[model samples]
Target chain A: MSRAYNFSAGPAALPESVLRQVQEEMLEWQGERASVMEVSHRGKAFVECAAAAERDLRELMAIPDDYHVLFLQGGATTLAALLPMNLAGADATADYVLTGHWGEKALDNARPLLRTNIAASGKAGGYVDIPPVGEWQLTPGAAFVHYTPNETIHGIEFRDIPDVGDVPLVADVSSNFMSAPIDVSRFGVLYGGAQKNLGPSGLAIAIVRKDLLGRHGRALPPIFELQNQAKNDSMFNTPPTFAWYVLGLVLKWAREQGGTAAIGERNRRKAELLYSAIDGSGGYYRNAVAPAARSWMNVPFFLPDAALDKPFLQEAEAAGLLGLKGHRAVGGMRASIYNAMPEAGVQALVDFMADFARRHG
Target chain B: MSRAYNFSAGPAALPESVLRQVQEEMLEWQGERASVMEVSHRGKAFVECAAAAERDLRELMAIPDDYHVLFLQGGATTLAALLPMNLAGADATADYVLTGHWGEKALDNARPLLRTNIAASGKAGGYVDIPPVGEWQLTPGAAFVHYTPNETIHGIEFRDIPDVGDVPLVADVSSNFMSAPIDVSRFGVLYGGAQKNLGPSGLAIAIVRKDLLGRHGRALPPIFELQNQAKNDSMFNTPPTFAWYVLGLVLKWAREQGGTAAIGERNRRKAELLYSAIDGSGGYYRNAVAPAARSWMNVPFFLPDAALDKPFLQEAEAAGLLGLKGHRAVGGMRASIYNAMPEAGVQALVDFMADFARRHG
Candidate 1:
C-alpha cells in the first residue's frame, strides 16, 4: 500500500510531489538546520515563506487588491461562526440560501450571532437540488447572502453564482475551492479549509473584501478581528507555520498544473467519467442528486442493494483505491476527485465500479 | 549548518527523533498508502492516533478523569478569548494576575466577553517579576482566576502556583507546558498551543474541568462550545490531524526520555547551564529577569552595550546557535531551551557566549 489513490473527501489527496518535497525538507528546511515546524514564525525565513504562500494564493486566484486574504485556523466552521461577527451590523439580518449540509451549518453557526433569514432551502427536496432563486424569501436590508457553493456531504454544487444584488455574497467553497477558476470579485468572501484542494487540515483561507470588515458594531477580541489579522498579515499571533508552508507548496503545484483553468477542465472530465459510469449502470448504480446540481469534486452514488456497500468499499481498498466510504448522513459511497487527484484515479474507480456491477448485478 | 540548536520561543524546537519519524512517514503512513495529512480525521487510524496522544499527555501530567482534554485550533490566543465565554456567567467577573505580556494579553482577550479584574500586575516592574499574591485584589465571587505560567517574550515564569481559595484557576501554560510535570488537579483549565514542547503549531490543547463548561450563560455557536468539542472528542469539526499525530509522536518520545519528571530535571539543568553562563559573564552579558521569576524555558539576556547585540546574534548564528535574537519588545538575545531543546544545545550556546565575551570584553 504505497500511496494509493486517496479520496477521503478532505484531508484528501495532495500532490505526491508536494509530499515528497515536505519529506525531503522535514529535518532541515531552507538550510535553517531545523524543520519548518521547528522555526519561529516571526523569523525572516518563515516570514518570507509565509509571504510567498500568500502571494502565490493571491496570484493563483486572481484575487482583487481590495480583498484581504487571511490564513486562519479552526477551518471553515470557525469562519462560519466568525462571518456574521465580522461582516454584519448587530441589528442586521443575514440571508441564507441553504442547498446542503454545509450551507445549513453556515446558517446555524451564524444564527447565534445575528438575525438570520432562510431565503431559500433545499432540505425539503432532500438536498438533491438548489432551491430556485425566484422562490427565495428576500430580507430587506440584509447584510449578506450566504450559501455553500459546493457541499461535500450532499454532493451538490452551484454551477453559477446567484445574483443577489446590492448585498454581499459569502460562499463556503471548501470542497470546490481550487478545482476551478472563480470570479473573486463577485463574492464578498470566499473561505474554506485547506485540507481539500489547498494543503492540510489546520489551515483555512479567507478571501475577504477589506471594506466589509470593522462594521460588526461590537467589540471583538483582537484575535477574532479580521481587520487586525489583515493588518498584521495573519501574524497577529503565531500562525500555523508548517501548514502555511505546505499550502505554499500546494499553490506552487497548482500553478505548475497550469492554474485553475486547466485544473478545472481536468476536474470536469473526472466528474463526467465517474457520473457517466454510475448513470450507465442500468439499475446497478444510482446517484440521487439532480444532474444539474452534481458536484465535480465529490460524487456520491449507491449500488442496487445497501448490502453491497461494505463489499464495494472492501474491494475498492483491495484494488488500492481508498476512502470511498460515503458520509454517514448519505450512507452509500463517495468518490472525491479533488485537484490533486489524477484522472487515472477516477478512471480506476470507474473501471472498478463497472467490474463490481457486472459481478454483482 | 546541518541542524542547529533552535532557541526560538515557539514554533520553537521539536525533538529531532520525532521530526525524523515524521519525515520517514510523510509519504505513506501506517500502510494507509497516504500521508497522515492526506487521510480523513474520522478514519480509525487517525482517531486512534489522536486518542493515543491524549492518553500519553494525561499519563505524563496525571490529568484527573473529571477533566476533559481537547485538541483544538487557533492556538493559546484564541483559547484566551474563549476562556471567559465558556467558563463565566454573563455577569461574572474574572480575576487575572498579569505576570508579563501574555498574561496581559489573556486579560485583554477575556475583557470583551465578560467583566475582568486585574487582581495584580507586574507591568509596573517592567514585567521582570510576578507581583506578590498578597497584593492581588481578588473579587469576592469571581468566576475564575487566570494567570500565565510562563511568558515567552518577557521570559518570566511563576516559580509556584498562587493560592486562590475556592476559585477555579485557569493557567495558560503555552511556553512551559511540558517542560515540567504539574499537579493537574490544581487548575480548572490548563490550555496552550502545541508549538513549544509538544510538537508543532496549528494545534492547541485545553484540559478543562467538566463542570466549568456550559456555565457561560450565553448562546455560543457549537464551534465555540468547549463542551461540544469535548463531547465530540475534539472532532466536532476536523481537528488538526497532522499536528495531532506529530504531537502524539513527541509524547511517545517524551515517555522514552522517562516522562515529565526526567524531562523537568533535564530542563532545569538546561536553564541553569545557560543562566549560570549569563550570571558568570562578569558584566558583559545581563539577564534582566529577577532570579526567582526567570523562565526555565526561555532565558532572555542582553549585552553590556546595545551595539554588541547585532554582532552577538551574527556570531551566534554563524556558530550554529540559531534563534538567539531576542523579541523586538526587548531587543537583546534569548536562548529558549524548551523540553525538546537538548542540554547539549544549551551547552553549545553557553560555550559560544563565553567565547564571545572573551573576544569582545
Candidate 2:
C-alpha cells in the first residue's frame, strides 16, 4: 500500500519530505560514510547538526534568550515526574488546572513529590470544557502552576495561557506543540514528547526559563536534573542522536513550510474543516468537546451508535485513511491532525465522515 | 565516499543490512502505509513488532524465563540511577566495582539515592586494567554488586564475570553487550544503551531478574519503577518505536549471522586481528590496557608521540576509516569493532594502520 493519511495520536504522521530525506541519508549522512544513527553524538558533524536544530527551533518559535531549549529522552511523562523534582522545594505546594486526561496525569505524577492543589478541574463535566479561570481556587505562594494546554485523550484544550499571578506556568504541550505560535515568555517550562507535532517518539523537548533551574534545593540523581541537562546542552549523556537528527530535519522542514505562523494558519484551517463536518452532521455525528475548548490537534467525535465504529474505521482505512480509532479511555473515533498532517488528509477524513454518515444514518 | 567502518564508542555503527531494511520501510512499513515510527505502539502491528524484538533478544541472550526484558527510554545512565531506587532498600548499602569511566559514572548517578561502598576500583591504576576479583573487598550483606563489564572510554574489559556469592551482580554492559555469549541467569540485571552493540540511541534495554524488582521499599514516581515498566511491557508511556523496531531487525540479523556463539568467535577473531596489528607495530603503536583486560570491542591504541595523532586521524579518514579519534579523556586512537562491524572492516583498518605506521615511522 502507498503511504496513507496516518492520524495516529502520537508516534503520529511525519512530513513525507522529511522521511524521504531521512531515507536518502540513511546510508551516509553528510559525507561521514555512516548513517546518522551510526555516528557519535559528540562528533563535530552531529554537534553542529544538533546546534543548527536548536537555532532553527528558536527562530521558528521566536524563543526568548532567557529560555533554555533542551532535547531530552524519556518522553513528557518523565518530565512530568521531573518537573516538581526540578522546579519546586520539598514542602512546596503546586497548583494544577485539570482540563482533561493529560492534566490529571500531570497532577498524579507530581503528587508523589509535592503538595498539589486542584486549582480548577473539568473532569466533573466529562472533560468537555475548560473550567473558567475566575472559578479556580489557586494556592497563594504556590511553587508553580501546571496544566496541559492540549489534552490528546479527551480532546479539550485551553486556548489561552491561564493567568497564574507571578507563579511560573508549566505546560505539557505534547499534542499541540508548534501547532500554533506560543509565547515562550509566558511559561517557566513548556515540555512535550516529540512524537506528536514535532518529530518522532524517543525524544522530548523542554523549553525552560533559565532562572527557574537549580532552585529546587533537593538532591536528585544527576540524570534526572533538568538543570544538569540544560548546562550540558542535553548532552550530559549520550542523547537520542538519531531522534535529534530527525527532529532537526523536521525543524528544517517546518522552516521550509514557512515557519510556525504559516503552519499555525494551515493547522487552524485543517481543524476547522474537520470540526465543521462534525458540527454540520446533525444527528449522525457528534463531538462532545465544547466549541471553545475543542483541541485543534485531537478532535474526538462519536458516531450515532457504538456498533458503527468498527465498520466506519474499516471503510475509512479502505479509503486510505488510517489511525482514526479513539483512545480506549474514551471509546469513540478520534482524528488527530497535527502539524505534519496535511490539510488534504483532514479534508479526506471530513469527506469520509460525511459519506459514512449519509449511508449509516 | 561509501560507508566507512564507524568505530564510534556508542551511537556507533549499525548493521548495513538493518539500515537498508529501515530505509526501505521508512515510508510504508509492513503494509501499514506509514513509517514504523508513525504507528501507534498499542496497535496490533507495532505491539507485535515490539514483542518480536523482545523475543529475539531473549533468544539471542538466552535470557532466563524468570527475567523480564524491558525496552526503555533514558540511556544506561538513567538505569544506573533507577537501579538502586528500584532494587535496594533506602538504608541498604550497594557494592560497586569500578573498572573505568562508565563504572565511576554509574556510581555517581547512584550515590545520591543509596549508601555506596566501593568493593573494588581500577581507577587508581588509570583504568588500564580490571582489578583482580580476588582482591575485591566483598560486602557481606550488600544489596547488590555493580560493575561495568566493559569500560568504553578506557578500553578496559573484565575477561570473566566476577564471583560474588549470593548477592546479585548488576552489570552495565553498555559498550560490550551482545558482543559475546554469557550466562544471563548469573545476573540480577544487565542494562545497556542500545547504540553500541544493539540498535540505536534513545532506547535502553534492561534484562532484570523478576524477583529483584519491587524489593525496594522506596516510594518512586510510577514512571521510574522497573516493575511498572515490566507490567506495562515498557509502555507505561510511549516507547521509542523506531529504535525498538531497528533493534529487532538487528537481533534478527544477529540470529542470521549464526547467533551469539558464532558472532562471539568472529568478535574474538576481529579483536585478535587489531590487537596483533598494534602489538606488531614495534613501539610505533601502544595500547595501555593489560592483554587480559583489553576490550575485544574497543581497542584503543596510542601513537609513539602526540604530535602524530592529528595526521594519523586525518590519514585514517582519508583512507575511509572513521570515528577513530580516541575519547578526549584518553588521547590517541580507538577502533570499536562491535557485532555490526564486519571483520573485513577490521582488516581494512589493520591494513591502513600498517601502511600509515610504515610511512610515519
Candidate 3:
C-alpha cells in the first residue's frame, strides 16, 4: 500500500522518511558493527549519539542552558505522577489548572504524591475554554503550577502559556511537544513522550530546570529521581537504548526539515486546513471546543448525526487517512495532525470530509 | 564487518535471522495496514500480536496456566522499585540474596519502599559464588525473597534457583530470561527487560503469579502497580508500542528456533566452549567466577597481566568480536553469551581467546 496518513493521537505516525532510515539501519547503523539497538548506551558510540541528540533537541527548542534535557521512559502517564514527586516535597501542595480530560487525569495521577489544589478548572466552564490567567486563584504556597499545553482527548489547547507568576510551571507537552518553538525560560519543566512530534513511544524527553530536580523530600524510585538520572546523564540504569537511538535519528530528521519552527508552521497549516473543512461544511460538521482554545494538534469534530461517524472514518481510511476515530470520551472524530503528518495529508482529509458532508448532510 | 559477533551485556545482540525478519517488517508488519508500532495496543491487531507473543513465550518455556504475563516499559530498573511496591506492601521485611552487582543494585533499589533484609550476600564471598541457601538468615514475616539470577557485571550466576521455602521468590532475569527453559511455577515473579534476550531495549516482560498482584497497601504510582497494568492488559497507558512490537517478533523467532529448550542447550554449549578455552589456556586467561557459578550469559575473564587488556579488546573488536570489554567495576574482558550469540559466535570467541593466549602466553 502507498503511504497513508496516520492521525493516531500518540504512539502515532512518524515521518515515513524516519521509518525508511530505521528500516535501512536495522542490521547496521552508519557503518557501526551492530545495529544501534545492540550497542550499550554507555559505549563511546552511544555516548556520542545521546549527546548529539540532546544537542539537536536543545538547538531545535532553543532550550536554555539552565534546563537539563533528560530522555526518560514511562511516557506522560508516569510523568504525570513523577512531576509531582520530583517537584513537590512531602506534605507539599501544588496548584493545577484543569482545562480538559488530560489535566484532570494528570491531577488524578498526581493526587497520591501531592496535595493538589485545583486553582483553575474548565470542567465547570464547559471544558472548551481556558481560564484567564488573571482569574486564577492559585494556592499561596503551591510548590508548582501544572497544566497540559494541549489536551489530545478534549481537543482544547491554551493558545498562550499560562502566567503562573513566580510559581514553577510544569507542562505535559506530550500531544504537541516540538511542534512549535516555545520560550523555554517560561517553564520550570516540559516533557513529552516522543511518539507524537519526536519519534516513538517509550522515549520521554524531559526539559527540566536543573535546579528544580532533586527537591522532593521523600526518596523517589530510582527511575523517578530526576537528579539521579541527570547526575548519571540519563544512564542511571540500562536505558531504552534502541528507543533513544531512534529518537536521535528523529532529531536528525527534524533538524534536516528546518527544525521545529518549519515543522510547526506545517502542522499549523494542516490543522487549519482540516478545521476550515469542518467550519465550511455548512453545519454538517461541528467542533465542540471554542475557537480560541481549539488545539492545532488534535482537532476533534462531530457530524450532525452520530450515525454517519463510522462511515466517515471508514471512507476516510479508504482514502488513505487513518486513525480519525475520536476518543471514547467524545465519540465522533478526531484528526490529530502531529508533526509527521504532511500538509497534503490534511488536504486529503479535508477533501474527504467535504465530500462526506455532501454525501451525508 | 562480516556479521560481527557482539558480546555487550544487555542491549546485546539479537539473532541475525530475527533482525532480518524485523527489517522485512519494519515498514509493514504482516498484512496490517500499518507498521506494528502504528497500531494501537488496544486494537485487535496488536491484541493478537501480544497474545501470540505470550503464547510463543509460554510454549517455549513451558510456562504454567496460573501466570499472567505482562509487557511493560522502563526496563528492569523500573521493576527494581516496582517489585517492592507491588509485593512488599502487605508484608514488611523482604529478604534479598545479593550475588553480585545487579543483585546489590536491585536490593538497594527496593530499600526505600520496604525493609530489605540481606538474607544471603555473596559480596563478602568475593562475588564469585552464590551463597548457600542454608546459610541465609531468613527474616521472620518477610514479604518475599528477591534475587538476580545472573549478575551481569561480576559474571556470577545462581547454580540453582533459590528455594525461598514458604515465602514467595522473585527473580530479575534480565540477562538470562528466555535464553533457557524455566519452571514458571517455581517463582512468584520472573521479570526482565527485553533487551538481553528478546528484542530491543525499552520493553520489559514479566511472568507474574496471578495471585501476587495489587497488594500495595499505600497508593502507588499507577504505572508501578502490576494489578493496574494487568487490569489494562498491559495497555493501561500507551506502552512502548514499537519496542513491544519488536519483542513480539523476537518471541516468534524464538519459538521458530525450536523453542527455549533448544536455545538453552545451545547457550550451555556455547558457554562451555568459551569457558573451556579460558580454562584450557592455563594461566593465560582466567574467569574470576567459581566454576559452578559462572553465568551462561556473561562470562568475565582476566588476561594474565592487566596491562594487556586494552590491546586485547582493541584486537578483538578489530577481529569482529565486539563489546568484549568488561564493565568498569571489573576491569578485564567480558564475553556476554546471550541467546542471540549463536554457537558459531561462541566458537569464534573461543578460537580468538585460544589464539591470543598462544601468542601471549
Candidate 4:
C-alpha cells in the first residue's frame, strides 16, 4: 500500500521530488495565468522553460557550443526513422553498429527511408558483449554511422565512443542519457526517446552538431525538418506541453544532483552493487551480458532454475518491486535503475534478488 | 489576480475542474504510486487509462463499434500528410473543401504526400463564407474528401455536411469538436488535434471507419500507421501521457455537462451573446463572416476605427480577458469560446467589449 519503487523501463520512474513540484504547479505555473499545458509555445513562460531545460542538459553533458539541442516528439522508435530522414539525403547510405535490440530496431526503422550498411554486431555473440569498435567495417563515405550507446533489452553498452574517422557518429542514447558523463563534441548527432533517462515518452532530446541541421533541406515535412524546427525554436507546431513542463522540473532536479557527473558516479556504484549480487549468487543468478559491456541502467539476469522465474516475479511484485520481468525476446528479469532510481532502490533490489537466490538455488 | 479568461485558438484553456483533478492526482492516481506520466504505457494502470479514455470518448461522441479511435501525436497538420498517405494510394487524388486557413494549410501539408483535388472553396470571399455543397465538382475517383468543419482563423463553419457517398468524408474538427452534437455516421473519418476542443496539442484523435483501418500498405512508419497503431493500442510507441491523461478528464467533464447537447446549447448562447454585442455596438464592431456560416467556437470581428485597436486590446487585457488578439494573417480580435469557457467568461468579454465600443468607437 506504500509507495512502490517503480522499475518500469519507460515511461519510467521519475524523482518524487520533481513530481511533487509539478503537482504544486500543475494548475498555475509560478502564478502564471494558466496550467503549464495551456501556455502557448511562443509564449515567454514556455520559451524560458525550454531554454532552461536545454541549458541544464548542456551543462550536464558538458555539451559544446557547436551542438544544437532539440526537444522533439516520437520516442526513440520514431527517432529511428527520423535519423535517416534528417541525416541521409535521398540515396545516401549509413553505417549501423548493431550492438543489441535497440540498435537493430533503429536500423529497421531507418531502412525504408535510406540504405543501411551493418558495420558490426554483437548478436553473433548472443548479445552477451558489445562488438568492439575496431571490428566494425567502417564505410568510408557513409553519410553517418549510427549506434545505440546503451541497449535497453539485452543490457549492453559501449564504454567508449566509436571512432569513425570523419564520418558523423550518431547514437541512440535513450537508456544512458543522464546517467553519466558523455562527450558531446564527439557526436554529429545524439538523440533518444526521453522515457528512459530523460523525462517522459512523448519528448525526445536531440543534441546535434549544428552543421548537420538544415542540410536535410526544407523539402522534408515541417515536423521532421530539424532546420525548420531549430530555427523556429521548436515551436513550429503545438508541442506536448505538460511533458515539456515535466522535463523542466527533471532538469532542475539534475542540477541539484550536481549534474550528470555526480549522478554518473552514483549510477556506477549502483550498477556495481547489483551486478556483484548476481555474480556471487552461485549459478542461481546469471546475467547474459558480458561484464565490460553490461549496461549500468538496465541489468538483465536469469534465474539458473528457469522454473523458479514465475515465483521470483510473483514474489517481487507482491513485495512492492514491479516491472522486473525481462523482455520476451530474452526471458528472465530486468531491473532498470535509471537516474531517478536512488542507490538505495538498487540496493533493495540486489538484496531481495540475492535472498531469493539463496532460498531457491 | 484571478485566473483570467484565455481565448487563444489552440493551446487554449482547459476545463478548470480537469486542471484541478490533474493537480490533485499529480503524484498518485488511484494510489498507483507513480505520476501518470511516469507509468509505462504497457503497464496495467496506463493501458487501462488509455482504454477508458477511448471508451469515454466513444460514449461522448457516440462513435459506433465499427469505428476505431486512435490517440496519436503530430497534430492535425501531421494528419494532413497522414490522411493522404494512408488513404490515397499510388496515382490517387483526394478531394478538399477549402473554406479558410486551416483547409488551405491542409492542402499544402498534403501536397508532397499525395495529389489534391480541391472540390470546393470559398477563398475568393476572403474565407468568410462556405462554398455551397451543391456547386462542388467532385473528383470522380478521389480517395477521400477532406475539409475543416470549423475554420479557426476565418470564423467559418460548414452548417451542413456535404454528402460524399462512399468516398470517405473526413473532417478536421479541431476547433469544433464537442461544441455541438455530431452525427458520426455522416463521415467516414473524423480527427482533431487536441489543443483546441480536446486537451493539448501533441495528441491527435482520429476516428476512422473500420473499413479504412489498415489500407496503408506500403511500408508506413509505425507512429502514423493507423492499423499498426490500433493493433498495438497506440502503444506501438509510448504516447503523450500527460496530454492523454488530461483529455480523459476533459471528456469526463463533458459527460457531466449533459454531453454534447447541453454543451452545444450553452455554446450557442455564448456565441449569440458576443455577436449581439458586436452587432449592437452602433456600427462600432463589425463581424466579417456571413451570418449563416459564422462559427460558434471562434468569433472574429474588427473595430470600426482600426486606429483604436491597440488601446482596445490593452483595455481588454486590463479587464482580465486575455488572448483576444487575432491571428497574424487577420489583424483584429478573435474570442474563441470552447467548451471550457464558462458562460460567465463570455458574458464578461461581451460586457468589456461593449463598454470599450462606447468609449473608443
> What is the C-alpha DockQ of each candidate?
0.87, 0.86, 0.67, 0.60
Off by over 4 Å in 4: A216-219
Worst 10 residues of 1 chain B by lDDT: B82-91
**Residue-pair clashes, model 4:** 0
Candidate closer to the true structure by lDDT (higher is better), 2 or 4: 2
Q: Which candidate is the best by lDDT?
A: 2
Question: lDDT per residue, candidate 3, A185-292, as tens digits?
Answer: 999999878877787778888999988887788876676688888898889887888778778888898888898889888877777888888888888889988899
Candidate 4, residue B17: Cα displacement in angstroms equals 1.6
Candidate 3 Cα misplacement greater than 4 A, ranges: none
The C-alpha RMSD of each candidate to the native structure, in angstroms, is 0.8, 0.9, 1.4, 1.9
Can you write out model 4's per-residue Cα lDDT over A1-361, one digit (the tens) per residue? Answer: 4567778888889998988888877677765677777766777777888888878888878899888888876677777887788886768889998888888888877777777899998888888897777788987899999999999989998888878999999999999987888888899988888888778777887888988866754355555677767887677777766677778888889989988889999999999998999898876789978789989999899988779889998888777787898888898899999999988888788878877877776
Clashes of each: 0, 0, 0, 0
**Candidate 1 pairs with clashing backbones:** none
In the range B1-361, model 3's lDDT, one tens digit per residue, is 4568999987889878777877888777666556666656666777887778778877887888888888888888888887888885734889989888888888778888888888988887679888888999898768889889888899887767777787888899999898787787899999989988887888888889988877668787566678988888788888888777777778777777788888888988988898888888877888888899889999999998989998888888888999998888888989999987888888888888888887777
The digit string of per-residue lDDT tens for model 2 on B111-155 reads 889889999998888999888899999889899999999999899
DockQ metric, candidate 3: 0.67
Error of 3 at B355 (Å): 1.2
Which digits, one per residue and each the tens of the lDDT, describe model 1 over residues A1-361?
A: 5789998999899999999999999999999999999998988899999999888888888998999999998799999999889997668999999988898888888988999999999998899998887788888779999999999999999899898887999999999987888899999999999999999999999999999999888889889888889999999988999899999999999989999899999999999999999998886889999999999998999888899999999999999999999999998999999999999999999999999988987
